[model samples]
Target: MRDGVRPPLRNHHEEAAEELGTTTKRDTINTALREVTARYRRLRALEEAREPAADGALDMDLLLDKRAYRPRGADSATDDHGTGADG
Candidate 1:
């Protein structure tokens, strides 16, 4: 690949190519195909395991409470601990 000729890896194929460290078109396409197939296999395994991993006593409403847990004066970007809200 030419220096300063590469564009931003906005698409999956480009991103996969970058991740695989391949410069050639054939290598990039092969890497992308491998990534997609690997992803599909992972998703299929998750789907197959879903039924066996189900918990009957799990409470979604209690576990997933939507109420904000910010302490007083935590409305600002950072808290007293100097950590941002996102942290």
Candidate 2:
């Protein structure tokens, strides 16, 4: 790694590295890069799925309402103690 080339990491990256079980800066960078690449690939796959194929058939309405696929548990109702909605 080049000196002064790597940017300063914020608290979020530290927390993410801890969560990902990466102890060193090099491991954290490698893990973060892999995660970002995977996320982009997933997004690209979804974007491609929404595109019309050679058949010229596309379900715009279904694709537009993709939020329905999310897991439902929390109702966005927060508590007074500053806990999550499920609290």
Candidate 3:
């Protein structure tokens, strides 16, 4: 009961997407992608840091996965348009 505050409701994604002229699925995908990518990076580092108990120590995959939507490295590609949209 504030001057302009409103009660919280469920499914805010739909309302936000409608206001932004987008689909809720797209937002969900974006959020999930970001979270997964971050988690993968963190997990990978953690796995690599753990010491092996015996002499069978090997490099851990660390569960790091390449991002599907990521662009190429700045040195690997050229950008004539000055915009990264091409990558």
Candidate 4:
């Protein structure tokens, strides 16, 4: 790195590399970039999910209705808490 070209990130890079156990600055930077991109991707996905779907594109209630969704062979006599209706 050229001296005095810009504010140095050496300290930050070294700290991140040590914490991450990366052997080189390049690896640390790449890992950081990949993590940042992954975080943004998750955020974008969450944002998109928050946006309302097209009409009937998805039934949010159906997804929320745990009673309607059951694992195969799960007893139908009980609610999600596993308490039977007779209780």
Candidate 5:
């Protein structure tokens, strides 16, 4: 109700940011930041519970081509082209 002091915004940061626009005061932003941090902590806790690993990873999608990773040239001293091995 007071003009000089700011009223707290609703829970949504994006909406609050839009309503506050560029001229947002410190208190309103601090409130929003606290809410965001709490939510992130909760989500991180859930993710950690889902992943038993200490690093919090499970069923990762990985791509590996053994042939591509290792070169055919490594098997022998000969080159792919007609160049002599002694040369």
Candidate 6:
């Protein structure tokens, strides 16, 4: 890993470290960076999905039909444990 000097952060390091289950500054920083990177990747994916195709026309039908992509048992009413009533 590359090492560089960073400005002193606010006093939340203790709280952040506790929340992230890390005891060292380096571990906490690494966990925080990974979370940020994952968040940005998810946002980028959503943005790309919203962009229109090269034809400038969006296929609203396929996008709106969520049932077509749902799993086989997704529509069944389940009990507290997620097993269907019949089970």
Best by TM-score: 4
Q: Which of the predicted structures, 1 or 5, would earn the higher TM-score when compared with the native?
A: 1
Estimated TM-score for each candidate:
0.43, 0.46, 0.32, 0.52, 0.34, 0.51
Output the worst ten-in-a-row residue range by lDDT, candidate 5: 56-65
Error in Å for residue 6 of model 1: 17
Worst 10 residues of 6 by lDDT: 72-81
lDDT of 3 by residue, 1-87 (tens): 358976564456666556556566777557657778999999988776665613456433433445443557774344644655566
Candidate 3 pairs with clashing backbones: none
Worst 10 residues of 4 by lDDT: 72-81
- The true-versus-predicted C-alpha distance at residue 6 of model 6, in Å, is 16
lDDT of each: 0.70, 0.73, 0.61, 0.77, 0.61, 0.76
Per-residue lDDT tens digits for candidate 2, residues 1-87, read: 258576556666788788899987789889989999999999998778757643458666665686766545554324434577565
Over 4 Å off in model 1, which ranges? 1-16, 55-87
Candidate 4: residue 57 Cα off by (Å): 7.4
Worst 10 residues of 2 by lDDT: 71-80
Q: Provide backbone clash counts, one per model.
A: 0, 0, 0, 0, 0, 0
Q: Rank the candidates by TM-score, best first.
A: 4, 6, 2, 1, 5, 3
Candidate 6 per-residue lDDT over residues 18-57, each given as its tens digit: 8999989999999999999999999998788777653457
Clashing pairs in 1: none
* Better lDDT candidate (4, 6): 4
lDDT score, candidate 3, position 64: 46
Number of clashes found in candidate 6 = 0
Q: Each candidate's root-mean-square deviation in Å?
A: 11.5, 11.1, 12.2, 7.1, 12.0, 8.3
Candidate 5: which stretches are off by over 4 Å?
1-14, 17-24, 53-87
